[model samples]
Target: MAVIAPAGDRITDVAGITVGHHHRIDATARVADPESPGAGWATGTTVIRIDAPSAVCAVDVRGGGPGTRETDLLDPSNTVQTAHALVLTGGSAYGLAAADGVMAGLEALGVGLPMDDQGHVVPIVPAAVIFDLPVGSWDRRPDAGFGRRALAAATVDVAVGSVGAGAGARAGALKGGIGTAGTRIADGPAAGVQVGAVMVANPVGSVIDPATGLPWAATALDLDTYGLTPPDAGDVARLGDLVAKQTVLNTTIGVVATDAALDPSSTRRVAMAGHDGLARAIVPAHSPLDGDTIFAVATGTVHPPQPDTVPPGMNRDVGLLAEVCRVAANVVQRAIVGAVLAAEPVAGIPTYGDVLASAIR
Candidate 1:
């Protein structure tokens, strides 16, 4: 007797959850809406926080050489446990500066790690990013100051599309690049719960259909509607040759937050489940060169208990934790897909529609 929400069921509000974000547009990238002027991130950071402990749990990368930090600590053995606070920024690995701002912000609000008798905070921040300055300039890298600014501007009603780490972002062939959405699961059946997501567009692949699991950008399009071009197909071996000539480092990362009461073990479960959501959106996901990561936090307000919360052989109930994590994983993946679809054409960058057009033609 298991009940799981099907895909595309806008469940932005599951528990008393909310979001806030800030985006900066780069003056460098070619924007489709030349007339559309927005804050340029050339360097900026995004901070997502839940009022209560956004529960804690997560899964690691599916690829080698994936860029990430504090992921290995999810094992429960590490001394690096954390409350709810995830920082997703713009500068590949270098953007880690954003976390400092987030930590400082959280510390100011007294929202993270138990304080020592001395009043010191053990901040555990997990971060991710994408390579933006591929056009020959570090003009799009996020900055630490931006992370601090994002925290100062954090809220429950979070925004999406060109906000946060997504400001200077782009996805597929569409002008699309940053997107955000939320759904409420609190009411008659699932009362007192909420699930929400904030995603950045910097994937090394495409987001597509749920049934076929194929990316729309990778398929043919019927342009009569918009004539979108599919994302440029990279040459396999021939592509490798070209890549060797031109090294392009890319990644897409974000955080998944929930109000479900999850322990360290359960947190890990939620983290794993969130990945399902990622796979649902991106084709050939978790590939090498992709620094995909997820952070699951529990506010401990709601108790969605797991009989065996700890993982086998471990000093925790990882089993039950993993189950809910799986559900969360599904939600996170959907969020990513939503971000891509929601992404609009920007600075001359074709929208997902444009990519579809090229493929169809």
Candidate 2:
């Protein structure tokens, strides 16, 4: 039997989490002249804010060329075990500056670690960026201001695709953007725990199957999430052309949030498992050219299910941790598909919908 997600099917389904996007769509010009001032300014930033001032967080970086900020602090051995915000943005290495803006915003709200006797606070905002420079105005990428605007616009109602950090994203030969999905553990030891993920899809690989004009993650798609139609003969035929045009500069970054109470080490494992979703959706993922990363955050709202017994060498929490990890991977896969499906064509790149429509036409 297929497992269906609860209504909303979004990362916000996890309590106390809100998402916001800030992107520039005005620059639609192709990346013909890389030296132009606004040649690739079609990028933006996405902010994931945790209402909890100090949400326990962990990160897993699988790609070889990741561009990130403050990730070292997320290490299990680091003194700070929590973060106030997570930023995902486009503009390659330059986009890491956006996290500084997020930190400034959090500081204004008095949300962060207390630092001095004078009531100073330092917001723990970790961030990651994708290389969308080749697709849009590379000269005009995201900056600190973009992060500030995204944080200001944070809300439970998220806007997916061609927005925020996904604005300039590209997946193989198709357009890529923001996508989110969530599910509740229904019948496991972790039942009632909510698991969710939000991703900025700009992989250096294809999310579609060449054999059919459909997403590789189609089996996990929910009702009407990306439409139920399968690719026609023509769509399948275009796959060869699309595959031939594949390039190498890209990355996919995201966060997996859950209501289950998990320690930092357990959360790190969840973050690692979350990458399975990326592998399921994108072909040839985590390549040396891609900077794929996933962060796991636990709001500590729901307690893990208690195991009946604990063996001498094993811990009782392992069962519940396994269930959370499983759900985390599933939601990540769903979110990646949602990102591709929700995407809109920009800078001459065709979206999944555009490809399907062209195929049927």
Candidate 3:
């Protein structure tokens, strides 16, 4: 079969996947008083749903400080290798409550494993959170309601930037937000495999190149997803000044999905490779203060190549798996860039566009 890219370049491009967001942006809080802290509410929750209730899943966590739930169950040796849903949110550890809401929502929809002779089912949902309390009102963090809302709103047309889990996110000195990207394997043994990524970018490192005012992943930009422009010398100089103000508390969390068939071990490898994409896009990434985590899911839509049928050098199954990993990393890098570019300024945090406008002026 020939590889055909999806019309939507976002993570929803992957078949059997849907994304949703629920956030609160307080008007008064938007206008923060430098003298007074925690004035606004700019945090929210994002949920990624797989059509298959038991899709194969794995997680890779590389940050020094990670706030996650049910990650241990994802281990290959664990009893449950499948996941029903995944949650990403802002609010530090407090945001974890949102997962409870997701569980309830899924339960209501009759999704999850059968508990016993009774009709009770338990949904396996893993969750992760980024520290956005510094930018938004700590009092108004994500809760069960936020998770339910996000799940209820799940759709193929995902909204990116300054929303969902990325609402209170900041990338170094610039605003951070939600972003997604996807691609189809055009050729080779992995032809027709569809891979995509959704990221809530709130990193402690820089996503832009100080020397060019462009995303470090500029080479991977597709269709000018962020409306990028070449930076002038002045813009470059300004970026240098901004990097000097790095902070120590932040995280970049996300999920990657593929239509290709993969077991739990393969999914774990893909998740690890996804971090490579993060490193490529963000300078000084996976820092002690950043809880950078990536989750991988395979819907098993397309079967891997048979080892016995393919050429020896090809190692078809292994080669295709590697290709999926490569695409997963690139998509992640692009997603991070998309988050920064599409973000709207909030809570006095400047966006990439705001910085661009200032530098050009």
Candidate 3 structure, TM-score to reference: 0.91
Q: What residue runs in model 1 are displaced by over 4 Å at the alpha carbon?
A: 1-18, 31-43, 114-118, 180-193, 209-249, 304-326, 353-361
What clash pairs does model 2 have?
39-137, 40-136, 40-137, 40-138, 41-137
Candidate 1 lDDT by residue in tens digits, 73-171: 667666655545567777667777778777777777666676677666666667776665542235556566677788777654445555567655654
By lDDT, the better pick of 1 and 3 is 3
Ordering by lDDT: 3, 2, 1
Please report how far candidate 1 places residue 32 from its true position, in Å: 15
Worst 10 residues of 2 by lDDT: 1-10
Shift in Å, residue 209, candidate 3: 1.6
Candidate 2, residues 115-158, lDDT tens digits: the string is 98787999889999999887655578888899999999998887
Model 1 C-alpha RMSD vs. true structure (Å) is 8.1
Could you list the CA RMSD of all candidates, in the order they appear?
A: 8.1, 3.7, 4.3
Clashes of each: 88, 5, 1
- Strongest candidate by lDDT: 3
The 10-residue segment of model 1 with minimum total lDDT is 1-10
Model 1, residue 13: C-alpha shift (Å):
3.4
Error of 2 at 301 (Å): 0.9
Q: What lDDT score belongs to each candidate, Candidate 1 first?
A: 0.54, 0.83, 0.85
